[model samples]
Target: MTKEEREQIATCIREEIETLRETVARLEDSAKTVDLDQPIGRLSRMDSLTNQGISGKVLAESKRRLLGLERALANVDDEDFGHCEECGEPIPVRRLLIMPEASLCVDCAE
Candidate 1:
């Protein structure tokens, strides 16, 4: 990728990281256990638990993506920043812009 592309991807990655941080925080709160002692119908309690479980799963994914983005940001300036790890080829600039944490090209990823 060009120097300008790299810089742009870096900026995008930073912004995504910030947004993911906020999402993770919100998910953490939502993922907390539902208060079973609350004076709610059993069906409502079940629904609350289900929602909490979904939130927990989303939180885990967000955290995983956040870590990947952080690692990508740390290596954004490296010589092989945009190279596919498996194919030793340059990854597409568009892909990097959309998913800065990706270490593989589309074909290799597939």
Candidate 2:
């Protein structure tokens, strides 16, 4: 990748990391264990539990993506930063712009 492209990807990754951090924080609050003794209807309790489970899953995924973005940002200046780890080919700039954390080219990722 060109210097400009690498810088752009780094910037995009930073922005995404910030957004994901906020999302993860909100998810953490929503994913807390439901209080069974709250005296609500059984169905309502079930719904709360289900929402909590979904939030937990989303939180996990957001955290994973956050970590990936951090790693990509850390390595953005490396000589091989834009090269696909799986095939050792240059990854497309458009793909990197869309997913700055990607380590594999589209072909290898598929």
**The candidate that achieves the highest lDDT relative to the unseen native structure:** 1
User: In order, what lDDT does every prediction score?
Assistant: 0.92, 0.91
Clashing pairs in 1: none
Off by over 4 Å in 2: none
lDDT of 1 by residue, 41-79 (tens): 989989998888888888899999999999999999999
Worst 10 residues of 1 by lDDT: 27-36
State the lDDT of candidate 2 residue by residue for 9-104, as single tens digits: 989999999999999988887665577789999999999988888888889999999999999999999999989999999999999999999999
Candidate 2 structure, TM-score to reference = 0.94
Model 1 lDDT vs. the true structure? 0.92
Per model, state how many residue pairs clash: 0, 0
Give lDDT: candidate 1, residue 75.
100
Could you tell me how far off, in angstroms, the CA of residue 36 lies in candidate 1 after the best superposition? 2.4
Clashes of 2: 0
